[model samples]
Each structure stands twice: as C-alpha cells, then as structure tokens.
Target chain A: MAPLIEVADLRTHFFTDEGVVKAVDGVAFTIPAGKTVCVVGESGSGKSITGRSILNMVPYPGRVLDGAIRWQPDGAPPVDLLALDPKGREIRAIRGKDIALISQEPMAALSPVHTIGNQMIETIRLHLGLTKADARARAAEMLAKVGIPRPKDRLDSYAFELSGGMRQRVCIALAVACGPKLLIADEPTTALDVTTQANILDLFRELRDALGVSILFITHDLGVVAEIADEVVVMYLGQVVEQGRVDDIFHRPLHPYTRALLGSVPRLTRHRPERLPTISGMVPSPFERPSGCLFHPRCDRFEQGLCDRSAPELDRYANDRVARCFKAGAGS
Target chain B: MLTYILRRILFMVPVTLAISLVAFIIIQLPPGDFITALTAQMAENNETLDPETLAALRDRYGFDQPMIVQYWKWITGIVFRGDFGQSFEWSRPVADLIWDRLGLTLIVSFATLVFVWVLAFPIGIYSAVRQYSWGDYIATFFGFIGLAVPNFLLALVLMYLSSRYLGASVGGLFSAEYVNADWSWGRVVDLLNHLWVPVIVLGTGGTAALIRIMRANLLDELKKPYVELARARGLSETRLLLKYPVRVALNPFISTLGWILPTLVSGAVVTAIVLSLPTSGPLLLNALFAQDMYLAGGFILLLSILTLIGTLVSDLLLAWLDPRIRYE
Candidate 1:
C-alpha cells in the first residue's frame, strides 16, 4: 500500500531582518499507515517546524518555501497540501479530520477558559456532523477511552481544574476524538514527569493499535524513541541524517550523528562515570550553517578534506536504511 | 459563588464607611468651613455682613457643631432619609440638585464608554493578530495620537470642525429648546444628536489606552501553545482568536471597570468645561471651587459608591468568565 503521507524536499524558512532562517531545509520523509515514526532531534533541529508545516500552520515571519506534502487518505485521492491555500477551506478540511496534533506542554496546549468537553465536542461536531448531544456523548466516551476516570463528571471541568497528567490525557482524547488517520505528537511527554510520561507513551501505543492511526512523533530523547517508535528518523541541523527500522538503527547505527546521539543517552545498565558523554559543539545557527557536511565540525570520525569539501547525499546501506555520511557503518 | 458574592457585599459596609470618613476628613482639611470662605468673599466684594445674620447663618447650617458631630449628621441623613444634606451654593437638598443633572451625565458617560469598547475591541484584535502588518501599524500610530492628545484639545478641535462645517452646535447635551425640558422622544433625539461630540472627546483617550492593552494582552496570548494547539485541531482562525486569546485579553479590561467609572464622571471635568456640556463634571468642579461642601461632598460620595458597585460587578463577571477564580 502507498504510504499515508509523502513529504518530499520540504523547506520551511523564516525571513527575518538579519537573514533567512532555514528552519526545515530540504527534508523528506514518509509516514506509513498504523506505524509510529519518531523524529528525534535536539532543539532547533526543525522537528517541531516540520510537524507544523504538515498542518500548514507555520506562524508569521515564516513560510513554507518549497515542499510537496502528498497525503493519501485511505479511500480518497491523493491531495497536495502545498498546492492548497494555507488559510482556505480545502486545507482546513484535511487538518483536523484527517490529521490531529498533541504538543509538549499540556498546561499550555489546552485553553484554560474552556471546558475539556467543550473543546473536544467542538472538533467532533465540526468534522463528524453530529448533534451537540451526540458530540457530548462521543467526547465523554473519548475521555473514558483515554483512561480518564469519571469522564461524565470531568466533562464540565475546565482545563485549569485538571492536573498536568490529566490535561495531557484530555489533549489526547481531543486529538483522537475525531478518529484522525494521522496524529502528530510533538514532544508530547517532554513536559510530563517520568511516571506520567510512561503512561502517555503507553496510551499512544494503545491509540495506534485500537484506532489504526499513524503517528509522527517528534522528540529529542532517544530513550523515548526506543520506547515508542517502530521506525526512527534522526535529524541534525534541519536535515534528515539517518532513517531506518528502530532495531536496525539502534543495533547497527550508520550515520555518525546518529551514533553520537545514541552514545549521549544515559544508560542505566552501564558503569557509573563522573561526566556523561555529550555530542561536542552546538547545533550551528541556521544562518551560519557550515558548508558540506553540517556535522563535520563536530564529528569524531570526520575525514579532514572530503567531509569538509562536499556534502554527501543520503546513501542507502545494508537493508532498508539510509545515512547522509559517505562512511556509513565504517566506524562500527 | 453565592457565598463569594455575599462575602463581597458584607465587606462593602466597612469599605463604604471608610471611604465616607476619608472623604469627610479631606473636605474639612482645606481650611475653615464654607462660612469663613463666604464671609471672606463678601468682605472682598465690600459687602457688610451683620453679626446677627452671620450667627444665624451658622446656626441654620449647623456650622457651630463639632467636626465629628457634623460628619455623623451627614452620614445619618443619607442613611435614614436618603438626603445628601443641603447644597450651600444652590440652597437646596444636595440629592435634589444632583439628581437634576445626574441622568444626563450618566447617559453621556455611559454612551462614551460603550463607544470606546465598541471601537477598541475589533481594532485591538486585528492589530494583535496581524502584528507588524500595515493595518496594525496604522492602528498603532493612530492609537498613540489618541493617547497623546488631551481630550479637551480634541474637544476644542471637534467643536471648531462641527461649527465650521457641519453647522451643528457640538456643545452641551441638548439643544437650547431642550435644556431642562421634560423627557420626550424629540428631546432624546436632540440629546443624541448633541451627544457624539462629548462621547468622542471623552472616549478617545480610553479607547486608545484600551486598544494598546488589548493588543499587548492578545499578543501574549497568541504566542501561547494553546493557540497553536487549537489551530492544529482545525479551528477556524476567527473562532480560535475570539474564543481563546481575546477572552483572556478581556480580563484587564473588565478589571478596569472600577477605575473607568470615576474617570467617566471626573476625568471629563476639563472636557466638560471646554465643551460647555451640562454634566456633573463642571458642576462638581464649580462646587469644589466655591467650597459648596454638601454639593461637592455629595458628588464625591455618589462617585465613590459608583466605583464600589463597578468593582463588585467586575468581580462577579470575572468569576463567571474564569473558572480558576470561581471558587476562590
């Protein structure tokens, strides 16, 4: 079957006074149906911008410069989202019904003044063409489905009345209330405590299984990627540096950036050290990005002349994996 | 919620007393009583005041009573008989004098307030939503002009323009024929025809200030993650803005209700004087200048009470709109 969505050469940029910020430059990926594809990156790696671009909700001062996001819904013809007007009805129709999103901060992601049930029911009624009463019933059922206790009573409660965990659960319930085919969770568990984070991850897994929803999960934590992702896409400096099955990437990593990212993860099974390993140097500012390989300045295995002289395209290696480095898998 | 309202009402008693006490003390602080000022004025005019007449004047108004006793009399008179004492200048009950013009002042002030909100709300939303765009910049520039120019100056300019071009008298709350006339549809229509000048003059400054505040508040709210969350959920842009950020931005505006009432009555003093409008503003000012204690003090008391009521109304509204404050 064709992938649920195909994003090709996506380049989202912000035109500021100083210079253009290449927030997401020449990015490409696909999310297959019913699978969780986690995009792992540090801050400014453009993961969040990429997710926002899919919904055509890039804020002011920024615009999607070039890209083709071909969305192939289960029974409908493929739609080119970039071709549609960002503020027009055709794109709007695809945003909430076909795709939904949950963000990092639950406290900041729910409108404080509105009741949880009102927000949920609004989305359901908007897309599903249901009566207010039916929408309320569906919202309560959605809340219960997401493990919110006493969903009927909780319906009247405002977002401010709930705890952080409960708010995130409400956000999840809201996202899945419309039965979207795709859900983009942009670091949904980052603001959560450890226990709540686990529960939320478990909830995502349950959602994918029960609703057959494809998830484009964005996070900077490799541990979370390991816990929830079926496929992993590692990004560095606005470009996809590596992509493969989760086990393939974790067990036999290819890209040096991916290897370094894995090395930086704090392991519970390993012996203790005074200082944990960290990826050397900072992610360069978008305006001051280095020539050739963006990671060459910080790569431990950098080839002095070749890596700095020319950029290497993503090369397929072994079975069904791609890495941007010329020396893929050589270090291992 | 009922208990909260009840608690607020109970608290108003001591607050009202405190305000009244302070007002009385301030009124008495300047110098000797109105009798002294009157005698001085009479002497300046080379009029001889007979001692017997002076003593009788003092006796009639109870000026011979102690300060505490005088304050007690004033408070009790209001509490028991709804009388605000006698206006020393007009020689009538303060209540009767104030009621004569209070209705017109209220209509003018209320109309101005409604105009301010009606103009500010939409422009504020647009300016914030389209920050840095040409439309936003134009509104911002004009808003600053409104704030910087005094209302009296604006009133003068408006008066000049209206008389110069429109051939309409832009002064007072009514035409000459309707001055002190009984209420009628024709009178009301005349009042409205003459109303816009004062309303525009008085409301401009507040409208400018409120627009800036609304824009800033909504800007802050727009940057919040919830706005993005709502947008990502496919909410139409217009609905998202009005339902979320604008609602939050309206808090400060509602809280300003108490401050706005006194301003509605008092802040227009200079504007009223300039426009020659028959509002409480000029009356209060003239009374204060003449040391007409009952008239001045009554206006102050009435205004203070209005402020308290405005605060109570805003508090109730806040509790209704924001769930976080409902129980507390």
Candidate 2:
C-alpha cells in the first residue's frame, strides 16, 4: 500500500536563550495508508514534536528547520506540507479537514467555557461548510460513534463536566469528526487510567477500521504499541533508532537501545525476578548531548572507540526494517 | 438561577443593615454632632447662639436623645416612609441631595467604565498575542505610566493643557454659560465635549490595571492545552484566540463589577474636586466633614447596596458565561 504521509530527515529545532536545541534531529518515518504507526520513546525523545511538525503546529520559538513532509492523500499528487507557508490557507485547509490531532491531556484539551456541542459544531461547520443544524447533527453522530452515551445531551456538557475517560472519547470524536485521512494522536491515552486507556485504544482501533483512516500514535507504553501498532518506530534522544513491523521489533529487536527498552518491560513469568531490568543512566539533557552515537554512553554493548568516534547511519535491513546501530543484525 | 438570585438578594438585607449601622456610628464618631459644627462655624464668624435657641435646635433634630434612640428613629423612618432624614448643611432631605447628583454621578461612572473596557480589551489582547513585540513594550510602558500617575494630577495636567493651548474653559461638566441653563441641544453638546476629560482621567488608572490583568490572564489561557487544540481544529488564529483565551480572560472584567459600582459613586473624589464636576463624590465628602450624619450615612448605605447589587449581577453573569460556575 502507498504511504499516506512520508516524513524524511525532519529536523525541528528550538531556539532558546541558552542555546539552540535540535528537538527532532534527522528523524524519518512513514505511515502507510489505513495503518497504525506507533512512535514509542521515553520522554524528551521528540516523538510529540515529530507529530506536531507533521501539521506545522510546532509552538513558538521552534521551527521546522529542514524537512519534507510529503502528504499523498487519496493517491493525489504529493503535496509537501513543510514547503507551504505555516500560516497560509493551503496548510490550514489540510489541517483538521485532511489531518487532525488528538492531544494527550484530555482534561485540558477542550475549552471549559464552551459546550462540547458548540466546539464540535464549529469545527464541523468550519471545514465542512455545513449549516448549524447539519453540523449539530454531524457532531451528535460523531459523539455517538465514539460510544458516548446520551450523545445529544453529552454535546451540551463542558470539559470539566465529563470524566477523564469521557473527555478522551470526546477528543477522539472531535479528531475523527472531519473524517481526516490521517489522525495524529500524541499520547492520547497516557493520562487515563488502565481501563480507560484500554477502552480508548479499543476506540482508536474501531475508528480506524470504521473510518479507514491511518493513525500515527505516539506513546511510551509498550503494551499499547503491542495492542494497536502495525508498525513501530522507536526513538531515542530525538532520532529514530529503530523501526519495523511490530512483531519483528518485539520478537527480534535490532538496535541495542530497542533491546534495552524491550528488556525493561515487566513480564508475568513463573520465576519472577526481584526487580525489572532498567536502561542505565538518564536521557541526557538536550543541551549537552553526548558525542557520536547519541545512546553510546549508556549502551551496555558500547564499543571502546568505534561507537564513541563516529555516529552510525541508519542500516537498512530485510522486510522493510531500519536500525541506526553499528551492530544492528549481529548476534547479541 | 432565579432562586439563587432571589436568595442572594434576600441575604443583602442584614448586610445592608450592618453597613448602615457601622456607617452611622462612624459618622457620629467625630467629637460633636451637626449642631456643634454649626456653632463652631458661627463662632468663626464672630456670631453667638443663645442657650435657648441652641437647646431648641438640638431638641428638634433629636440630638438631645440617646444615640440608640436616634438610630432607631433614623432606621424606622427610612424603612417605613422612604425618608432619609434632613441634611443639616443643605436644609433639604438627604434623599433629595443624593437623587439630584446621582444621575450625573452614574452617567460619569458608567461612561468611564465603558471607556476603560473599550480601551483595555483590545490593548490587552494585542499585548498578550504579540508578547515581546515592540507594540507590547510600548503598551506596557504606557500602562505603567497610567497606573503610576495619580488621577487628580492627570486631571490637573489635562486641565492646564486645555486651558492654555486650546483656550477652552476647563472645569465643570458644562461651560459657564450653560452651568444653570435648562437642558438644551447646545448644552448637551457642550457637556459631551467636557465629559470626556473626566471620563479619561478617572478611567486611566482602571484602564491600565485592567489591561495588565487582561494581558496576564490571556497569556495564561493562551498556554492552556485547549488553545492548541482549538488551533488544531483548523480555526483561524484570530477566531481561536477570541473564542477560547479571550472568553476566559473576561472573568476578571466580570468579577470586577462588584467593586466598580461603589467606585463609581466615590472613587474619583479628588479628581472630581480638581475638575470641579458636580458629582456626588464632593457632596458626600462635605457631608462627612460637616458631621451631617444622615446625609453621610445615606451615601454609605447607597454604596453598600450598590456593591451588593453589583456582586449579584457579576455572579449572574459569571454563571451565564461558565457552566462549571452555574452547576457548582
């Protein structure tokens, strides 16, 4: 299948008073049409920034310094999203109508002063050019699609009036309301409880199937990746260290950082260890990034001179897989 | 909502009574009553009041009675007959004096409120949205200057500049010719010409303070996740800003209504005196100085009632604006 969006060598940087911080440096990924691509990383790994850069919604002081986000919606001629003006009408027409976002903070994602119905109706009307009555009907239909009970009444509810779970559902409903081809969910289920998180993941799967929309899901939860991702992109320190089929990435992970991440997940074996394995050392502060391979300082398999002397390019492998490690496919 | 408002209104009765009692006591706290103040004035003029006339005046005004008995008479007369007692200085009913000035006072106050709001809202939004731009810096500088300079001093400066440069007669709500003239189109036009000076003078401090408040509030709201979410909805930047952050920023403007009413009546006292405007502020000041308890107490009670009403109106408006407040 053709990829819905192809992000190549995307470099987003934040210019701060202290110095310049390359937030998402040389990151590359692709989301296939009608497929879920989960971007997994620890905090500060630039997963969220990569997601935001796709929509040209990076916050102030941050710019997409060099990148090409080729969006080929419905097999139309490819449009380079990064090439368009960030504030121009072309990019705006693509946003929400062709690509929408679901934010992590459900509690703070919706305006407290506006009703759910008011917010939903406005978005529907803005992009779809529907009348108020038609927008209301569409909003109500979208709310019901996300399994919100009493969808008509729920439309009148405020963000603060709903539970955390219900709010996430509303956000999901909002994201998919315009029937965008690609949905970028930035840690959409991170703030929820375990059950609600599971329910939201299930909702994402159901909506992806029902609407035939692709999803770029950013998360730190391996379990969510396993449950929902068709492909997985593992990031470390603003770079995509490894990405492949979820089954291959989980069963036979290539990059040392990917192995370390997989090892850190707790298991339910008969002989339980005293403690779960952990990746040693902290994710270095953005300002003082280590030389050579970004993860070399903490890699247990770090070569004495080679790993510290020069950064390794992403090594392509069979089955459309890629890993940025010197010893990617060598025996562990 | 109706029940809530009614409950709040019912709750104001005791509040007003307590305020009236405190105001009446504070008015009486001075060394002597109105009769004593009159006697002192007479003595200053080298005139004397005989004991017989003095006793008769004191008896007639109920000054000879106990303080509690005097308070009872005052409260009963106000509640039962809507009379606010006689002003010792003006020899007129206290209600009449307040009513005569109340109209102009309200007009000035409401005009100033409108002026402050109209100026503050856009300037505040611009400063917040542009943030560190040169426009923001310029606005911040002017805001600080407005807040720092005293209103009366501003009034005086403007008065001086107008009289000197424009050769305009620069005091009162009308020109000298129209001071006691009947209402006419020309007089009304003249009043409008003079009204803006006092409105701007009184509104400066309020406008400056509200601008800072609005900017800070909008800046905070602009950072909320909801604002980003709104922008992601493909909403235009201007629409997203006004719909989300600006709506939330208006809370301070609404909540300020509680104090804005009382300030309307008495806030610009020095400024009014400096400009020679016929507002209630100076009248209330003189009433207190003359130890005219009824008139002074009446003004204080009116202020308290206005404050309560203002609070009620703001609360209702807030409830209308925010669902959380309404349900809560």
Candidate 3:
C-alpha cells in the first residue's frame, strides 16, 4: 500500500539578513499507517521543520520551495496537502480532525487566560459539535485519559495552576480528543525529566496501539528513539542521512554520521575506554555546502577524491535499511 | 466568584480613599487665600470685609483649618452623608454641579469609546493582517498624522466645517435659536447637532491612541506561540486574532485605567472649548483662573475621583477578564 502521508522532494529555505539558510533542503520521507516513526537530529537539523511543514505552518520569511505532501485517506485519492488553499474550510476540517499537532513547549502552547477545560471543550465542541454539557463530560474523560487527576475539578483550573507535566498531558489530550489519524509530536518530552519522558513515551505507544493512530515523532534524543520508535530517520543539515527499521538503525548503522551519533551515546556496558567518537567538524552552512555529500566535512570514512567531489544517493544495506554514503557497499 | 468579587470591592475602598487623599493634596496646592477671592468680590458690593468676617468666610470654605482637619471633614461628609460641600466660583453646591455636567461628559466619553473601538479595532486588525499593504500604509499614515496634529487644531477645523456644511451655528451645546427653548426632542437633536463636532475632534486623538496601541498589541500577539497553536488547532484566523490574542494584548492598556479615564479630562478641555459645552473642565479652567479656590478645588476633587474610579474599574475588569491577575 502507498504510504499514509508521503512528502517527496521537500525544500524549505529562509531569506535572512546574513544569507539564505536552506533549513529543509530536498528531504523525502513517508509515514505509514499506525506506525511510530522517530526523526532524530540536533537542534538545527530541520527535524521540527519537517513536522511543521506537514501542517503548512512554516512561519514567515521561511518559504517552502517545492514539494507535494500527498495524503491518501483510507479509500480516497491521494490529496496534495501543499496545493490546498490555506483558508478553505476543508483544510481547516482536516487539520485538527485528521491531523493533530502537539507543539514543543507545552507552557507556551496553551493559553494562560483560558482554563484547561475551556480550551479542551472548545476544541471538542468545534470539531465534534457536542453540546456544552456533553463537551464538558467528554473533556473530563479526555483529561483523565491523559492521566490528569480529578479531571472534573481540574476543568476550572487555569494553565498556571497545573504542573508542567499536567499541562503537557492536557495539550496531548486536546490534540487527540477527536481521534486524529496522524499525531505529530515535536519533541514532546524535551522539557520533561527522564522518568517523566519514559512514562510519556509509554503513553504515546499506548495511544498508537489502542487508538490506531500514526505518530511522527521529532526529537534530538537517540534514547527516545530506542524506546518508542518502530522506524528511525537520522537527519543532518536538512537532509536525511540514513533511515531504516529501529533494529537496523541501532544495531547496523552504516553512515559515518550515524555511526558517530550512536557512538556518542553513553553506554552502560564497558566498551573499549576511548575518547567518545565525536564528529570532528560542524555541519556546513547551507550557503557554503561542500561540493559532494553534505556530511563530507565531518565524515571520518571519507576517501580522498570520491568523497569530496561526488554526492551520494541512498543505497540498500543489511536489511531493507538504506544509508546515503559513498562506501555503503564496503562493510565496516 | 461572589466572594472574590465582594473581597475585591471591600479592598477597593482603601484604594479609592488613598487616591482621593492624593487628589485633595493636588487641589489644595498653591491656591492661597481661597476664600479671600470670593469675600473680596462680595466686598465690592459694599460689604465691609473685616478680619473676623474674612475668617468666617475662610471657615465656611473649610480653608481656615489644617489639612488634616479639612480632609477629615470632607472624607467624613463624603463617606457618611455624600456631600461635597459647595463651589465658591459658581455658588452651586458641588454635588449639583457634578450632577449637571457629569452626564454630558460621561455620554461624550462613552460615545467616543464606542466610536474608537468600532473604527479603530477593525482598522488596526486589518492593518496588522495586511501589513505594508496600502491599507496598512494608509492607516499608519493617518495614525502618525493623528499623533502629530494638535487636538485643538482638529477641534477648530471641525467647528468651522460643521457649521459651514450643515447651515448650523457652531457654538455651545445647542444652536442659538434653541438655547432657551424647552427641552424637546427637537432641541435634543439640535444639541447633538452642535455636540457632534466637538465629540469627533475630542475623540480623535483617543481613537488614534487606541488604534496605535491595538495595532502594536495585535502585531505582538500575532507573533506569540499560543496564537500559532490556535491557528494550528484549526481555529479560523479571525477567531484566533479576536478570541486569543486581543484579550492578551489589552492587558497593559486596560490595567492603567486612571490614565485612560483622565484622558477624557484632557479631551474634555478641547471638547468644551470647541463646542462651548458647559462641562466641568471648562468651568474648572475658569475657576482656576479666577482663583475661585472652592470651585476649582471642587472640580479638582471631582476629576480626581473620576481618575480614581477609573483605576478601580480597570482593576476590577482586569480581574474579571483575566483569571491570572489577582489583587490580594
């Protein structure tokens, strides 16, 4: 079957004072139905940009260069999300109902003036056409579903009265109340502690299994990917360097960039006591990208003329996994 | 909510009292021999003004005593019996003076507010949303001009043009033909006819101020993440702007109620002069110049009370609109 949501050849760039920052340059990926796909990258690697672009919410001064994000709902023709007029009610209906988004900062995401229950019920009422009474009861149920204690009483409490975790859960519940087929979580646990992050990840897994919702998870933490992701995509400088099932990605990484990233993670088992295999150089600025592969500046597996002058395409590795590197054919 | 509101009202008493006390101090400053001016005028009508007689006038005006004693008397009378004593300039009881002019100013102010919000909000929102478009540029051009040009000049032009256009004489609250005519519907319409020019001119700067404030606030709110989240949640752009952002943006403007209310007095200065309305601002100006201390002080106290009440009302509104703000 075709992917549930497929973004092919997406390019997003920003025109700024200093130079054009090609924030998301020619990235391609697909999210399948009922699967949790985690995108792992550092701060500026354009992982979050991919998530935002799905909703057509790239902020001003940053324009999507070109792409067709096609969506094939259960029995329908694949609709081009990028081509839809932003103001049409059809797009609005599809947004929170079919695709829900939980943003990065939960504190900043929720309106402080509105009580948790007010915002939640407002959304339920808008999407479901529930009566105020029905919406309230439904909101309370959703709140409890997100593990908020005393859901009925909590409805009267403002955003400030709730803790950070509770507020984040409230955000999640609001996003999921309509049973969106696709839930895009952009680093949902960044502000949370380790234990809370684990619990939250577990909650996401439960959400995917029980409700049959597909998740597009974006984060910088490889640890989170290890716990929850069924498939993983590693990105650098706005390009996906490697992608595969979760097992192949962690156990049999082939790309040098991916290898450096996995090696940098702290391991409990005693490995050869060597300095952490840090990537030697920074990702090149978009304006000054190397002639060849985007990762050539920091690729330790680089060979003299081949790595510097020629770009590489994705090559099949051990499983159906793929790595975008010149020497993927050579076993490490 | 009832308890919270009751507690707020109870707390407001001291706040209002404190403001009134400050008002009292401001009014009492630098206007020496308040009673002498009136008593001297009386002396011109062949009344012999001896020292004892002068002291009696002073006592009657409540100026022969210490500040504490005068304050105590005014506060006691105000709290217990709702009396504001008398105006030395107009020879009218202060309460009666307040009663007569208060409605006109309040109506003018309320009308001005409605006028501004009705015009400025849409204009401001349109400007921000279509930023740098001709509508934005045009709105901005007018906003700047509104800030630069003096209110009095606008008042003058309005008076001149209004009379010329409508074949109406541009003087006081009513046309000369109806000045002493019975208070009929016809006369009321005539009153509004003359009143419109001053109201428009007086409210011009305030409306402009509201426009600029709303524009800046909306711009700021539009950039906020919550607004972004609302849009992402499939809220229509209009709903996001009005429901989420405007409420957040109005906090700073609404919080300082005293300043905004007292702006009416400033507007009233131009309004009374332009329309020849018999409002307290013009009366206060005349009394101050005539050194009619009792009359000036009475108006000052009234203006100050309005300022204080404006602040109190804003505080109450802030609490109501934003559950986040608390007085206690």
Binned by DockQ into CAPRI classes (incorrect, acceptable, medium, high), candidate 3 is medium
Model 1: residues >4 Å from true position, as ranges?
none
Model 3 agreement with the true structure over B13-74: per-residue lDDT tens digits: 78777877876676677557656556666778977667887777777776767987888888
Candidates, DockQ = 0.80, 0.76, 0.57
Q: What ordering of candidates by DockQ runs from best to worst?
A: 1, 2, 3
Cα deviation in Å at residue B119, candidate 3?
Answer: 1.9
TM-score, candidate number 1: 0.98
lDDT for every model? 0.89, 0.92, 0.79
Q: Estimated TM-score per prediction?
A: 0.98, 0.97, 0.90
TM-score-better candidate, 2 vs 3: 2
Candidate 3, chain A: TM-score?
0.95
lDDT of 1 by residue, A87-163 (tens): 78888777778899898899989888888888888889988989999999999999999999999999999888888
Q: Highest DockQ: give the candidate number.
A: 1
Better of 1 and 3 by DockQ: 1
Write candidate 3's Cα lDDT for A4-51 as tens digits.
898888888888878888888888888888889899988889998888
Model 2, B149-231: lDDT tens digits are: 99999999999999999999779998889988988999889989999999999999999999999999999999899999888
Q: Counting only residues 3 or more apart in sequence or on different chains, how many pairs clash (N, Cα, C under 3 Å) in candidate 3?
A: 0
- Which scores higher on DockQ, 1 or 2? 1
